[model samples]
Structure formats: structure tokens, C-alpha cells
Target chain A: MTIVAKFEIPYLRFLDSEGKINKPLPHFAKNSRDLISLYRTMVLTRTFDAKAINLQRTGKLGTYPSSLGQEAISTAIGAAMQPNDVFCPAYREYAAQLQRGVTMAEILAYWSGDERGNQFAANPEDLPIYVPLATQCLHAAGIASAFKLRNQPRVVIVVCGDGATSRGDFYEAINLAGVWQLPIVFVVNNNQWAISVPRTAQTNAATLAQKAIAGGFAGEQVDGNDVIAVKYALDNAIAKARAGSGPSLIEAITYRLCDHTTADDAKRYWDPQTVEQAWQEEPIKRLRQYLIKNKHWDETQEAHLQVECNQQIEQAVTEYMNLPPAKLTDMFDYLYASLPAIYLEQRREVEI
Target chain B: MSEITLVEAVNQALAYEMQADDNVVLLGEDIAKNGGVFRSTVGLLERFGPQRVLDTPLAESMIAGVSIGMAMQGLKPVAEFQFMGFMYAGMEHIISHASRIRNRTRGRLTCPLVFRTPYGAGIHAPEHHSESTEALFAHIPGLRVVIPSSPVRAYGLLLAAIRDPDPVIFLEPTRIYRLVKQTVPDNGQALPLDKCFVLREGSDITLVTWGNMVYETLKAAGQLAEQNIQAEVIDVATIKPLDMQTILASVEKTGRCVIIHEAARTCGVGAEIAAQLAERCLLCLMAPVKRVTGYDTIVPYAKMEKHYLPTAEKIIKAVEDVLSYEG
Candidate 1:
């Protein structure tokens, strides 16, 4: 047997850095509703994130992690996923969750420190936010393994940050997926920073995609700020995985314009000029510019989009705040099928 | 009735369960081709192929975390941790996820997973090879701990553990894996998880123990019998959801109790048993409960392991002290 050339980083670009589409973009839908939906979701996500940070400042929500500049990656990847497919996300994928099916109220409730936010919806399609970093990668592999064993034609998508690639679970899960030929697509949102540590301090590898080669898997690096590029990369990866070809890794190279979370201040560790330069490549702005240049959007439509996004966000916040306070017993309810004796005792104490 | 060692009995139970249910899968290091380090998973790979009997990397956390996901997806996974001492690496998954998945999912998911490991001292193996950490699991909610002392009990309890709807930690004593032999029934009926079995019944004293120490307690009881001291031996198989009624009844009848375990004395299962007996059966006790357990020190290498574990002599001494008490 002979080894083949390393997998080329797959990509499909519609817009260049100067905010110009290479050619006339195809219209998949007859009425341009699809494009309008995508734009609306992006604006809604940005509005929700800003509201979350404001809530955190007002002591309404707990520490919030704002996905300010990474909306394109989440929106595009989430759009490519089928409703039946399982999505395992890290803490910063609130936009992805909302687009997949989670309501804005539910997202706000989670950041407000309520257990109900993590509860499975009536028709559960995704798992709760896994907080232990790359551990979710292993779960995604297992889910995909189950699908393969049962001969199910569903793909499992796992979303992680660049910092998670350094964890042991990431390597173990990817290696297992490769060996078993399980149907899994790993998306790494390389935002260039892990808390206070920058990407340079995380690993010497020039690109996170190259790390996948060590595990005998195919990989690609896409411009995460480009919505169309992210959607095309994920769509092809998902298609390959569903075809029984094994796992693939996509590293979305983006930047976090905001602090890590409300609790962190990035200015202390990162150069202020770097932050200023990254803001120019914001994902939402880049996509909006592409739409305007293609004659698909104008200032009148932009004004209408802002008004629509604000109204939707205000309604969601009103509904979320009006809901009853969270029950303390919810903490112990989902821990087991039968309540263990210790938790029973704790519940009794809480009642007292 | 064919007699077989504890390891053979465990292997037979796995073979029977896999044949009975297609959802049962075994995954661990060397369990597929090499038949495991102690050969507890021998012949499983040949019978179940690579999909059912997966050979995984040496990462314990991955093995356990993936099992949790598999179990959530409606598969019964039996994971092996080469040795009980190495379970520390996977403790977070076991404690945080496996034990809480059923409740965390609000019954939307159940982790019917079994973690099988060889535990206890007397193997004379290197450091970190023999450890008895059942107490730590017993303290956690939503998990069941099963410790079978004989071949027949191990087979029946293991079957029960696999079929149970919750996560079960099956601790097999490596010291007695090859030493004990009995006729295990071929039929797949499992013994209950939280019930105790009386190995030898006597009204003079109640000796409660499980795992390898059960044999030692029985030997001590036999030696006491020679001295006109009749002692009852009860094997408390499941540590969590303990059989308190059976124990309280035995203590009430015998008027004295002695607990034995191979784990360290501090915060061990023996303490919990003693405390429960004190709270429930205090008035009936003729003397304070006595405990024979290992010291609170790291399990040393083979050279000094004999001094680190509890022996028959220690159980007999504890029995004598309890019998000689005037209060």
C-alpha cells in the first residue's frame, strides 16, 4: 500500500477581503427568503449577546461569554445541520444553539444560572452545554459510533474552541473516530485566544487543522468570518461523514473581538492595536458588506433589519423575565432515575 | 454442576449475556485480542468481533466517557479498567457523568453501564496494582457497588449488574479471582443487587463482610467453631443501597457484630456499617461493634503487602474481643 497526498483544505468562497463576490451568487430559494433568514438570525444573535453582557453588568445574569465576532461560523454551521442530527457544543455556541432550535429565552435563562435552561426540550435534538472542554469530543465520537452500529444515516457534529485542541480528550476522540470510521464532523472555532493565553502559547502548530493529520484524518482551515465559506466547508464535511467515509476536522480561523467572558478583561493581556485590527474583520459586517455589493441589500433594508432584530429580542427578554423563579429541587431531579439517599436527605433539608 | 474459578465464571457470564442481548458491548484495553491482562475477557472478541469487543487506547477517561455516551444512546456497555487502582483517572467521568446521567437527563436517558475492575490486595503485584476503593463509590449517589466473594455469586451478580437500569461498579477481588471455585448456574437469572446472602448461619455472633474478606471471615468463623464460639457469616454483596434490614436482623439475633474489609479503616464501608448498626440496633447489641480492616496507608509493593491487608487472624482477634466484652 502507498500513502496519498495530505488532504487539501477544502473551501468555497463567494466574497474576497475587499467585500466583493467573485461572481454572481446563485439564489437557491425563489424569493431570497433563505438569505433574509440567515441575515435575521445573525442580527438576532448579536443583539442577544449584547443584552446578555448588559444583564451580567446589571447583576441579572451570571458570567456571560459573548460570541461577538463569531456569528458567521455558528450561523453557517448550524444552518447546515439537519434537525435530527445531534449537536454537541462548547460554552460559547449560544448562537449555534439558537439557530439549531433553542429559543432566545432559553439561552438567556441558561446564562441567568437556571437549571431549566439546560433541561432537554420537548423534542430533544441536542445535548446540554458540556463545560469540561474537549470531553464533549469523546461523546460525539460515541454517538457517531452508535449511529454506525445501528446503521443510522445521521451525522454527529461537535463544536470546540481552539484551546480545546490541546486537551487529551481531543486526540483520543479523533483517533478513535478515525480507527472506527465513525460519522463525525469536528468543527474547531479557532478564535486565537484561550482565556488569557493566546494561540501562540497553546501550540507550535501553525494551524489547528494540521493537528488532525497526526490522527490519520482529513482536515481543512476556512476563514471563519466568512459565512458562505463556513457553510460550504461544513456542508461538504457532513456529506462525507454521512457517506461512511469517516471523520473530518474543520478549523474556522476567526477572532474574539470581545473579552473571553464578562469576568475577563482582554486589554490586560492582549495588545490594544491587535483588538482594533480584528474588529475590521467582524463576521456580521463582512457578510452585510457582501450582500450590499451584490445588490441584495440597501440602507433601507439594513434599517428594517435592525428594527426587526430589536423587537424580537425585546419580546424574548420580556417572556424570559416573566417566567416563574427556578425551583431548587430541579438541581437533584435529573441526577438519577431513582433519587439516591444522600440527595433525598439534601432535598428534605431544603424543604425544612 | 461444573465448578470453575471466579475469572472463568465472570467470562461465562459475559458470553451468556452477549448471546442473550445484542445491545451488550465490551470495550477496554487488550480486551479484544489479548483477552485482557487477567484473561477475564477471553474468547469474547472471537465471539463478538471488533465492533462489540473494542480494543481502545490506554486513556481511562476516554474509555469511561465514551461508555457513558454509548449507554445514553441505548447500548449496554461493559467497560474494564485493567486494575482498580488506575480508576482514579476515570473517576471524574464515573462520578460526575455516569452516576448522574439518568437524573441529569430527567429520565430521557439512562446509563446502564457496568465498570468491571479487579481490586484488593494479596496479589503481590507492583504498586498501584491492588486497591479497594468501593467506599468512594458507595458515597456517590445514583451508582451501585457490587462485590461478589465466590464464583457463583460473581456470575449471578455480574449478570444482574449488566441488566440493571443504572450504572454498576463491579469490583472483583484479584486475590481470589483464581482461588475460589463453585458451580455457577448456566441460566441467566441474576441475583438482586441490594440483597445479602448468609454463607454460614450461627446465633452466637454475626460476622459481616464481602469480596476476599468474606473468605477470611468464614475461615475465622470456622476456627471459632472449634473453640465452641459459633459465628454467623453474612456476605453483603452490594455496598450502596446496603441491606440494612438483613444486617440489623442478624445483629439483633446474635447480640454482637464484627465488620471486615480489605480497604483502609478511615472512612471505609466498615465505618458506615458501624454507624448504621449503632443508630438502628444499639439497644440489642451486647458489646460495641468491632472492625478488622487495613491501615490507612498506601498499598505497598509485594514485600510488605502481607502486612498491609487484613487476614483471618485479625478477624478472629476482633471476634474474640467482641465476645469477651462485658458491656
Candidate 2:
């Protein structure tokens, strides 16, 4: 038989794990302010994650997913998109939400079991964090279809975990995006473990990014711990999408440096040696090291930034705790455009 | 006004809505070029062109999910499933995302789309083609389950489902898609949702039903009227926010009730109406509520379908049983 088709998967990396330059840097790297800003956002995410886990442990918050080692993936996607573009996030995309104008107090309030926490005043087009794995991919495709139908220049960005690639929703979503040639970018945070199921057991597709090739799109992999590499790949993909280049998938290789959530104990399944090795390549420390070596940051600035983050987190906690409780009618109020007669009568007994 | 079949009425209503509102679009497998498997969307693609009338892949989950995304973005998408049984593949998107988008976002976003599918056992179709699973969609809190029994009702209700600002499960009865014809005015008018239609009025016994079972109940009511037992017939157009007021008011007058449906007897919509009557209208109920429904088994293949569906004779028997009760 004659040859049918051939495809290749690409990989991208800039700064290595040891703060050494692995390749020539992009134009954005020359701007020290941009790098410093990205670094600051990663630090803010780490601080916010620690406080959220502490609150969960103290019984002040609901179950929370930490962005511990996967900060670069979320932060880069958040910083790459424009304001009119849509952002569809997975459950652990709090870092991206923060960068997209969602308040720290709003995040804290949502984790405290209040629905009002998701009411983002600045970004109404941004979807709330989806808990059901890769379902947001389909929503992203739909949003992209709307933009394409209306002939708009905006793009949509969606993120999911490594395990989400195993679900049928993921394949179905990408299939439609490819067929329609929609303007959306899908990023996979391959942090090695999907809540105790290792990446080895997820699939044998060689690499998750290669899955895009079968759906008729460009697929590439990047070093997720290196923030510079993530930003470069996402910037290129977002630009291509805006120029009507259809969809692209980026598989960011990283590790889960901490437990899956406060409700989980990684020691039960993960090997101690693996965890120790992963800690050395975490995202925040790599970015911090890159900033310090480049003379863009120093010890005094780091100390001052830590103090400010602590004060801001404390203020958010106070505001979240002092807010009035949600009304009981909130359950019935938002269920439909207008309350039907049946619900109106049922709402009487619950009224206080 | 012109005489048209139920399926033709569906096509006209869709065309009218697409012509009136630029945001309304159609998508499903074989819906655009093939005009749908049942010809319910026949002439939509030729009229609206390919941009508004989309023909998606054979992925039911993406079809439902993409419609939700479009609705959230201020577009009114009307998606169709080839058959009701195939809706199982899209149930996760329906129950989790489409039904919960409004409540999940705290009213910041709403899913104003219609998921249309042909259901019930008839026309000698295959195993998966014949199903009456309206109860499943009705069980979802944020969904509105609407079914049309005649041509005019189909036109009016389809228009209303597209205009409503929430997700609606529009289940059309395949058994009666072209069984009869009626004059439906293409005036772009929409009937109020979440209300029941009183098809026939009497005072002896009330026969409450929806979808295909409405035909059987009306036939039984006519038979009862000949035997000096004038029965009241109520067609429950919307199943979810069941206009229990109309059913309750009819029960209050007739003092007896019997519900007929083609779905399974266990946990069917008929059970909900029966339970509600026991709770609110117990004082006026002269006899225990009776249910005439299909068996608690999977809808059988073509040969056994006749035994699986609720017939007019069975509904008449149920009405007679309720009338014979002296307690």
C-alpha cells in the first residue's frame, strides 16, 4: 500500500530546571518587567494555595485543589489571552482565575461554600472552575464556534489535567474543534499523577500532545516548570488562533509537588524518593532562581513581597469571613429565568 | 392557517424561529443535509443555509455540550437527537452542564437551548429507537420537559421552548408524528410554558396524560362518555413543572383520577402525579389514583411492542376500575 499520512510531535523548552539556559530566549525574555511580573504571579499563587490548604485543614473551607507545582501552566494561559477572550478553567485553575481579575476574596468565599464567590465582576465571560474533569473542552469548542459563527477575532483557552485525556469527553471535544476549525487552545497539565493513578497507567499514546495530530491540528510539548517556555508556546498558539489558524494542544510536562488536595495523603501511594526528586523542579523555585540570576530580583525585594502577600491574604480571609450568609431562596432563584408556579409555592415553606 | 402533520409543524416552527431571530441555529447528525432521520428538520438547511443549519458528527455528547456553549454565549441553539434512546450518551452533558449552568454561575450565564428527540414505541422501529424516557429529563431540577400531542400544540410549544431562557427537553412522540393533521397558523406566536391543556371536559372521572398517551386517554374518554360515565381529559403539555393546578382542579371536580403513560411503571412521571394527589387532594379523592403505564421492562423489539405500549382499552379499564371503587 502507498503511504497515507505522516505527522511529527514537537517539544519546546527555554530555561532548564537548574536555572541554566537550555536554548536561545524569545523577545519577551529581554523585557525584565514582564519576567518579573510573571514571577510575582507564580509566587502569589503559591502563597494563596498554602493559605487555602490551611483553611481546609482548620475546617474553615471546603475541599480545595492546590496548584502547587502546576502554576506555570495556569499563569501563562491567563497572561496570554486578551480581555474579550474567554477562559475556561479546570477545578485547580485558581491561579489563572486570579490573574484574570477574579478577586482573592471571591476565591476564598467560593471555597467556603457560597455561590456568590463565583460572581466575577470584571470577567463575565469567564466560566467558573469545572470539577468534572475534561468537560470544559466541549464548552470551549462551543464558545469558539460562537466566535467563529459571528466572525469575531477573539479566541478561547481551556485547561485540563493529565487524566482528563482518558475521558471520552476530551476526544469528542477535540474532534468537534478540529472538524469546525474553531479558534481555541487546549492545554494539558501533565503533573504525573491523576489523584493516585500514575501517568503511566493513563494511556500509551506516547505523548498526550500527539493526540492532537489525529484530530488535524498542531501538537507540541513544553517544560511546564519553566515559565518562559510555557509563555512562549501559549503566546504563539493564541496568536495563531486569533489569526484563524484553528486549534492547538500544548502538553506541559510537570510534577505534582504536593498532595492532590488537603483531603488526600500522598504518602499512602507515592514513593518518597519520587516526591523528593519532584520538589527540586517545582515551578515557583525555578522562576525565582531565574529572576535572581538575571539581576531582576534580590533578597530584600523577596522579603518585602512575602510580607505583602501575607497581608493581602489576611485581608481577604477577613472579608470572606465577615460577609453575610447567602439567602435560602438563592437555591430556587437561579434555577430558571423566572420561578414557575410550582417552585413559587414550594418556596413558601423554606422562606424565613 | 394551513393543515399540516406534526412533523411538518415542527419544520415550519423551526423555520419561523430561524427567520425571526438571527441567533437561532440548528445542529445534529443528518439534520442539515438529510433533514433529520425522521424528516423533522426537512427544508431547514435549504432555507437557512449551512451557517445556521449545522450538521455535526455522530457524537451526541458534543452536540448537547456545544449547544450549551452556544446558549451561554447568547445564541439560541436547537439540537436534535436521532432517537430518545441515543440521548443516554448525552445525559452527562444534559444533567451536569446544560441543566446546571444557570444555577452554577448564580444567574451570570444561562443555557437557552432546546434538545429535541422523537420517542415512544410505534412505527415498528428497532430496539433503541422506541423509548419513553421523559421521566429521566423531568427528574433534573434545572430542565423543562415539554411534549406536544397535536400539530398546533407542536408548533406553539416548539416556538415557546426556543424562546424560553433555560434548557428545555423537547420530546416528540414518534408514534403520532404523522398520525393525524390539524390546521396550525404560522403566526410566530408562542404558548405559555409550564401549563396544561384541557382537551375534553366532564365531571365523572379525570384522565391525565401527556405525549403519545394523550391520544389513548382521549379515545378512552370518548368510550366512557357513551357508557354514561362522562370523563374529563387533561393533556399535561409540560411534564417537569407539572401544572398540578389543572390536574388538581380537574380532580377536585371529578372526584376520581387515572393517569396513563407509555413509560415504565416504576418511578415514572405518573407516580409523581399520583403521589402529589395523595398529598394535596386527598380530601376530594373519592377513589385511589390509578396508573395505566407500560411494564417495568425494557421496551421490547418490534414483535412485542404491541404488548409494551399502553392502549386505549387499558386506559378504559383503568377508568372503569377507578369508577367501580366505592370507598
DockQ of all candidates, in order? 0.52, 0.84
TM-score, cand. 2 vs. native: 0.99
C-alpha lDDT score of every prediction, in listed order? 0.85, 0.91
* lDDT per residue (tens digit) for residues A1-352 in model 1: 7887645555446655566666555443223566666777788888889988988899888898999888888888778888878888887787778877777787788778765666656437477777778888887887888888888989999989999999988988888888888899999999999999999999998788877787788888888887777777888889899999989999998899889999999888988888888888777776677677767888999898788888888898897888798567766666655565534767876552
Score candidate 1 by DockQ.
Answer: 0.52
lDDT of 2 at A87: 93
lDDT of 2 by residue, B10-123 (tens): 998999999999999999999999999989999889998998999998899999889988888999999999999899999999999999999988998889999999999977
Q: In model 2, what is chain B's TM-score?
A: 0.99
Estimate, for each residue in B241-282, the C-alpha lDDT of model 1 and write its tens digit: 788888899999999999999899999999999998998889
TM-score of each: 0.93, 0.99
